[model samples]
Target: MKRMKKVAALLLAVVMLASTAACSSDKSWAAKNDSLTVPIGSYIYELYAAYYSASSQTGDTAAGSASSQAAESSVLDRKIDGKDAKTWIREKALNSTKSLFVIDRKMKDLKLTLTDAEKASIKTNTDSSWANYKSTLEGYGIAESSYQLAAAEYSAKYQKVFQATYGKSGAKAVPDDELKSFFEKNYTDFSYVLCKLYKTDSSGNYSASFTDSEKKKAEAEFNDYASKISAGTMTLQQAADAYKSVDSTISVQNDTANLKTNLQGYPDDLVKLLDGMKAGETKAAEISSGYLYILATKNDIAKKTADEMKTDDGRNNLLADYKGQEFSDEISKEADSISGVTINEKAIDSYDPSMFAAEK
Candidate 1:
């Protein structure tokens, strides 16, 4: 009957509509492997991060403008490290997403599970971030779940993998002795009292250089303090305190520890001098083209007590420095070896980095 044919046609139309909707959803996935499915939103999150990272490296401050036209043009037209900015951003996002996938796969292979504390930390961090940037992130089409997936969850997984590979009881643990040797060779611990040869105005602005007599007096005082410290009559902290009392312009940094050989703030000559000095040795150095003088004393890191090493977890930082690059290289190797990764170019091309640039 005609009525029966009409009903069958209507059912077929409904089925076709359902099928199309399902296909549309599938197309929204940015990537996937046998065991992992990366949502489009997660890919967008990676793109967002890559965009900002490139912007920061190229010093493209205008990329964060409210005007989408300006921000998009600025970012799209830029070049980074000999590559087009848009291309760099896309490649970085894709590679970073693959890295995340590798991390997840490795974590599963290694039977690694985040601790309850870590889970709570991730939730707390994600919740805090969502609270602060909910509107801005949502405006970029990043859902709360995708932000959690790409940010805190991804970070926690990476940390877990790093620890499993390098922790004290890890399968590839570096021996304590080796770590210590690396620490001593690559790190420096020292304290200093700085005497500025420039005078300050009432508002504490640099006004004038010290007279030759003032410079000589400052140098003589620092040399005397260095002598006292070298003689063991005054500790470095005691000398710093005493110098500050005498010259109000003096700045004292006591027990500054774990400074790498490439020390910042201090001049290159001073860093070279510090590198060559032994523990318990005190020296007076003219830095900043003789505009300032410092009485510096190098400290022995080998003598750090267990309790002292726990202070600020200096030991952990040292371990990170010693093994961080090696661990990263290993992760990159494993990530590259992973097979069956498929990226949805259509889904990726649907979005643009400029879409995120309008966000503050």
Candidate 2:
């Protein structure tokens, strides 16, 4: 998970930079006509275009066109694929726009009550934050104020989330009995795994991209290990060690969870892969992270008195995180349903740089 987190952080940085750039081109639009403005979704596309244009500035759309075409190339080659790459990128762009809008909406609910010193400390710690935003916006060929407005929008959304969850009326609704049951059912078992996955080449790098043949080979290896354990021929540790010796692209680590806060929407295959298995069981086949393998172990389960679990202190300090996550998921679904939203696909399709007349 930590390794996955490292990848996530990098992706987040890229996304933030991209988002900032996309939101920063309002001034360019303004130059053409003082009253000119893009519709909501179109603004998102223009922002995305500016960001990509900044990264690959050939002054022509040729670079963006070529890159998008390559993502589609795998489909033409008969690789197991769905959707054209350009369409995929566009969808992602739209989803991103919606997400940003959601975030800003959430922010509008929260209040960041920080002391004077803490506020000052932000500059010392985050001096480069705005500069970074500015640079990214500039690179994406967007205007500075456009990016600033995007930032403000996101900030508003976050405020809303905080306010909605814990403002005036307060969001303290998770019951004592419910929290205790959740904790008991989801105790951490100090389990560990040593895993190896197939990659394109001999060099060991776990990439999201892999050939089908390589994927099969990796799955075959994990399956053989699981079979041996199931048959009682090889111990889980022994299997882990043996697999490690053969596969250089392997990682070993321990995992423990006191509460399954973020486990929702996780593929059932993954849950079952870890479920009901004792510390020494290896799973058959890989469900995720290429080829999956686990040397399961149970951690010590803490037993607390009913009163201890039911106290206000317990709910607030102990199980607050889990409760918050549960509430977030529930509220998000409700919001989606109430919004009665359908995407404007035609608007997205009609987006063209030529629509914006040139500056005088």
Tell me the alpha-carbon RMSD of every candidate.
Answer: 4.7, 17.3
Among the numbered candidates, top lDDT falls to 1
lDDT of 1 by residue, 8-62 (tens): 9999999999997776557558888888888888888899999989887777777
**Candidate 1's TM-score:** 0.77
Q: Which portions of model 2 show Cα errors greater than 4 Å?
A: 1-65, 68-114, 117-136, 139-149, 152-164, 167-180, 183-190, 195-252, 257-268, 276-293, 298-360
What lDDT is obtained when candidate 1 is compared to the true structure?
A: 0.79
Question: Cα deviation of 107 in candidate 2 (Å)?
Answer: 8.8
- The local distance difference test score of each candidate is 0.79, 0.48
Clashes in predicted model 1: 0
Give the best candidate by TM-score.
Answer: 1
Looking at model 2, report the run of 10 residues with the lowest lDDT sum. 29-38
CA shift at 331, candidate 1, in angstroms?
2.6
